[model samples]
Target: MCTPNDTAVLHAIFNPSAPFGDIREDKDSNIQEDPDLDSRFPADLLEAVLKLELNGVTAAESGDVKTAVQKFTEAITLLPERPSAYNNRAQALRLQGDVTGALQDLNHAVELSNGKGIAGCQALVQRGLILRLNGDDEGAREDFQRAAQLGSDFARQQLVVLNPYAALCNRMLRDMVQKLREPDTQDC
Candidate 1:
């Protein structure tokens, strides 16, 4: 359904802020263009990582998923271990229906964050939505549970569709972790 030059199409979908399912772009209002930050970073290998990030954000906002992906990839190349970059890129991939790519980025973000559970929670929520969209409901549920336990209110909201279930899961998971931490309580 997407052409090779879908970057233009993607850009159009994002800029204008279309409805929830109908992402469209506003090409006329693109007020900013990056001036090659990498070139200024060094005389040789310019690490334009920040510039790439801005481009990624703009392209994502404009519904230009392909360009967003390229921009994010460039940022990753400049800073391979940055967690937020991966998380942001995952969001753009999800918007473009590239659920697999999004999941990969989210997984990488989680791994790079070392379970700090801040951006990791955001990545988990994105992964959960991708799983749900891809018909892996059980996986989606697990991801959402992890995200909610990490204190993500957005993930918790999604879980609350089954309020009692979500609460039970949270309590059980927390108690389990607590017990593990207190070896004396592990018998429970």
Candidate 2:
């Protein structure tokens, strides 16, 4: 029952070539510039992080939440500033019923990205889901709106669901159109 949007999200998450594009571009203007911050990572650290992240994804997909969390934690320890590990760990935490931990990780992920990158968008969507589950529809709507602005189709879909007026109007319009289309029900 995976929708097209679900497929697209999976593709985006698994596609290595998809450019996340300079997450630091939105950094605070007052911060001292460090030219080395933009430099490429040491090859060994990069490889380790990639491996750890992949392992985390695999464990999560296999329903091993604890293992996934451990792997993601390792990756985060290795690169504390990397948002993807925090975002991925949040998923595992949520699956394990650690909603508070998930929210904290998601918050960190969003902050690390300055709410301007793929990781931030993903974290926002995840947080929206959590908020909806916690019966905070308004908060969920706000998160979805922000995530939608950042190009998350999943968030856009959630926005449609959260908008009761839109749903009601759509349903009413469909019923009316259907009635008009019915030859016997339509008044000539």
Candidate 3:
């Protein structure tokens, strides 16, 4: 039996762009300009890591989550300090039904990025979803708030849903609209 929260979460997960849940696909949008990021790694190593991450994403998209995890692991091994691989791995792990592993990797990704980059935003959003599913509304709200501060529209939407007052108001407005659409049937 799905609760109201569960239904809301399902809707958010399925139709996030218009309103809230999935990690944003626009990688560049959440990236914070950090000059040291480029200076810290050799160009060749960065290129290699990018390739591995792309391959991992492809494998995950193809439903080969195990291969995706392997590829992400290889990328992390190559560049342990980079947060992207960890974020990618967390998604694959979640697909593989390894929520604990996914959460751990997400935490690592957020920490590595100092919660200020694409990896951080993605990690936070993903983790927030997981927390919401686990019925940890406060934890989910905190993560979503952090991501919202980083300019995540989905996170902002999640925050609205998480707010009791906002949810009540939204439901009331929806009820009013529904009533307005109904034909009057009372005898004059």
lDDT of 2 by residue, 3-59 (tens): 655555555566532322211222321112335432466768867987998998888
List the candidate numbers ranked by TM-score, top first.
3, 2, 1
* CA lDDT of every candidate: 0.67, 0.77, 0.82
Indicate the residue-level lDDT of 93 in model 1. Answer: 81
Query: Please, what is the TM-score per model?
Result: 0.58, 0.76, 0.82
Worst 10 residues of 2 by lDDT: 22-31
Clashes of 1: 14
**Distance from true position, residue 39, model 2, in Å?**
5.0
Residue-level lDDT tens digits of model 1 in 18-119: 212112223432222233422334543333666787888888777788898889888888777667578878888878877788888989987876544445
Candidate 3 lDDT tens digits, 4-116: 45655765676442213434343424435466765789889999999998888778778899999999999999999999899889888988999999999999989998887
In model 1, where do residues sit more than 4 Å from their true spots? 1-48, 162-188
What are the per-model C-alpha RMSD values against the true structure? Answer: 15.7, 7.1, 7.0
Model with the higher TM-score, candidate 2 or 3: 3
Residue 131 error, candidate 3, Å: 1.1
lDDT of 3 at 181: 93
Q: Global CA lDDT of candidate 2, please?
A: 0.77
Residue 17 displacement (Å), model 3: 14
After the best TM-score superposition of candidate 2, give how far the Cα of residue 76 lies from its true spot, in angstroms: 0.7
